[model samples]
Target: MTEFIPRPDQPASTSRMPSPLVTMIVAGAVLSLCMGLRQSLGLFLQPMRAELGVSASAFGFALALQNLTWGLAQPVIGMFGDRYGPRPVLVVCGFLYSAGLLLMALGGPTIGLNIGAGVLSGVGIAGCGFGLVLGAVSRSVPPEKRVQAVGAVSAVGSLATLVIAPVCQAIIENDGWQAAALSFAAVAATIGVIALFIGGKPAPAKDHSAVASNTRQAVGEAIRHPGFVAMTLAFFACGFQLQFITVHLPTYLGICGVSTEIGAIALGVIGIANAVGSYVTGRLGTRYRPKQLLALIYLLRTVAITAFVWFPVSAFSTLAFAAIMGLLWLGVVPLVSGTVARIFGLQHFNTLFGIVFLSHQIGGFAGAWLGGVSYDLTGSYMTAWVSMALVGLGAFVLQWSMDDRDRPAPGIKDSLLGTS
Candidate 1:
């Protein structure tokens, strides 16, 4: 009898899956730090504008630039992560992130702020944010747990928003915005070190099907697929709606005669809700069509926004909206990431997902920049908010139309639990 052995590229990933707990924890921690830093940038706009005498639009443009740059760089960085592993990419980008924060501190409102916070930080986010971390964690697990892995990491990262938003607000309130930025920078510097422990060991292959496919062919197929196009379009709306709210909510609150502190807390609330919702999202994806779940998520978002915008502004309504919107917040991640992974396989997950994320950041750019421009023009965020609600409907429609059939993965179940 001849013994069959797998090659290095297809080594027993399923059997060798390092501790899923470790992957979740470490990747989650990295996401916590990176997301905490990235999402908290909005809290600075008021102080920075007041100190530097720049219009709301100008500050928004800087943030918009950051989104655009992050989107543009993610594919390249993701390719690096796919080829060389995530650790090296994360290690280098961690330094860049720290430097970007420090530059924001040193430069304040100058053009350097755009370069530091927008350009450099955006690039760093591409390397260290969910684009890389989710994939890394997913890679550490067996095929069965891949969706759960991404969801778990996303939930963990969402927890950071719950904790970090208040911290950013508190820091900005007392120690000042620069202090918060500097503190986050210091935290980001530790990500590379932390990445060492996360999802480094892949599980042994559980089956013969865990093969490495050609990255180019995968990319080409995905690009040509209508489902992938729909996925990207929906994700772009996700970016636009999320960034518009994250970056402008503080100012939006002020326009509504509400306190900015409330906005901060709202962000935190959204994070907490998302943390919970994302976990369920992963589980639900296993049992239901991912496209249906995505459509539902966007529909919920649409409902939440429409209700919030139509009602009178009050603390209770705002908080209620936050809680609802938060649930809708990150539920999209696992679905998007898992869908792509399922469609194309994990061999080129980082790059393929990164392309999807690039579409997202383009939406983020418009979302963040437009809120400011709209506010400056009309003295309110009504336009931006309303536009977001409409976009949510479009996303809902697009997601519903996508092909949700699971491709063949030797041991994996092809049909969702509820589907034929």
Candidate 2:
């Protein structure tokens, strides 16, 4: 009998390999563009409100729709990305995003504003946001470095805020808000083109035999796990905190008597600090349990919110809050995504994680909409701030209780008990 051996370079081999650095760079750029555009929405709130003659509630509703839409669509988009590859999804989402921006630029009454800015732009975001991009990155990079790669990708989103916020503000100030919207739309369209550069064709469809024996088993196993549930709920808090602040922080500052310039600066500061936070958290994730780190991050956010509420408003306080909050901002993303990958394997990470992220967006919708509604009702942000603090504490407790362990394989009594 002849001896059989596997070749080293065979595509079917299970050997681990590092993804090209260029893949990371491209992923970062795509994330940056997506996040930068999302964060820049705050800059347009006031101007759009004035030009369109819409109420705060109307603007808030539009933003709320955006968040809700993104949340609802994320899981679906992620599933498709996982099945079909991220490149096509990115391209399609880019076009929808640009169209949304263009519609907003046209200026409108409440219906148009809500539909364009809220619904259309949101759909775009769902397809292009962290869910799809991070999924791609997770597949490309080695398993050991997955957490770090997530951090790097998240850092790009933060960096986009740092660069794009100021640039959007300047455009609005110099060329006017309409021009700025057009310019932003142009940039978004460019992202569609850029997404074509990402390599890796989609995985081929699994045959019926393979699907029943392996794929179905894996999906069923992950769905029944307790840790996955905990991870999903914890991520809800992260979304609520980030979306509420990012959407309303600029407007909140305005209510406190801060200038537009200061508001923009505050956002820029948050972005810069967020970049630092992401980098640190990414590195720390390698050594620490992500659940514990999440608890700490939420605690810090609670402290930051309390301090901002207690302090008197000034240029100093504004910048201080920005810096402190930015540090806590977006730092949770890597850890959250990393934890999911750890407990549930990356085989169906995109689809599974996207479902988790959908919960986050639901929180985000509440945060953004409620902040505006509270302000409209009471003409003060005190209530909103108090609510944020309470939510932060809640998140701390939730994350603390999560058990970190590898999930058991299906149909194995010992492994099931081990997971339990």
Candidate 3:
């Protein structure tokens, strides 16, 4: 049998991969559950804070821990997904996610919130979120189509936000935050079903049996690569920009005298807009350099944030800002993952991407937590908002500095998945 030279991590039994559309759908559905649940949690901020009798800073810190832990766990979870495939990781993490929500509903002390919302849910997100899904979808597609596939998968999350945010608001209004959290938990627990349908596998190294060695080598090389390092720094800015808005936009709008209902609607508008933006960005990613696109996206975000803060806060402004921000939202995710795949190949793509995503989570921690802290101390979010724009400028510079050209290293080699 002629050897298959250009395999992008298909299952071992077949030289060719499974259907890209099927893999994308499965990954997208799972992401819908994971991302949608997180999106709705912003609505819980005021309610939970009021009930818990905590300052915004304290509550925000707990959520910051969620970002922190998620970033910390990403590489480990990616390792598991790379070693054993995403199914087991997804199944286990989905249950962990449910348990975390249930614990949060129990409503004991601050420690419980940290344990539930911070640690457990963070780990859960690491396993079930972008790195795992994007890696799977990337491996299932042709090299030419990788960014588009990843973007389509990301758009599902945005679509979920559009659909689930309203539904979550309705549930919270009718049932209570506890019930809402439990309901979201149930949605996450169902991700196992989608995991079963997801296609593709870890890329086989020259020595197929040496999975562990291959993983370590891939990780080591990626960490040392200048392009990967620059990409990670750029990603940190993306996380910081996104989390501040996603987690606190509802609360911020409410402070601006916007009704909670309107705030929720604005978030949904962001979702619908993001759905379009992510897809369009993905298509553009194929036509343009991912790094350059990312830099441009950051520039756009800086401008959007500037306009949003400068304008008078109102129903129209809130929705318009969200719609504009939504288009930029998650557009970077697929591009980041695609750039990783394009430069490195499918071998250990999950783990490599996870490591890069860790930087984003750290920024998430700073963005979400600091926004609250700044608001509590200064009585406005101005400090954090201004800071976010500054960081966006920094991110654009770092992305511009990245060298996407492939260079051989100890562990990073020519891609087996190269398009002939």
lDDT of 2: 0.76
TM-score of 1: 0.90
Q: What TM-score goes with each of the models?
A: 0.90, 0.89, 0.91
Angstrom error of the Cα, residue 293, model 2: value is 0.4
For 1-420, candidate 1 gives per-residue lDDT tens digits of: 122121212213534334668767888898877887788788888888877786888878888998999999998998787766777788888889888888888776765578888898888888888877887776666566666778878888888787778888899889887788788788878987888765443432233223434566557767777888899999988999989878887787777888888988888888888888888888777767788888988888888888888988877888898898888888899989877776666667788899999999999999989999999999888899889988989999999988655444332232323233
TM-score, predicted candidate 2 vs. hidden true structure: 0.89
lDDT preference between candidates 2 and 3, better one: 3
What's model 2's lDDT at 196?
79
- CA-lDDT, candidates in order: 0.79, 0.76, 0.80
- lDDT score of residue 405 within candidate 3: 68
What is candidate 3's TM-score against the reference?
A: 0.91
Q: List where candidate 2 sits over 4 angstroms from the true fold.
A: 1-19, 202-220, 409-420
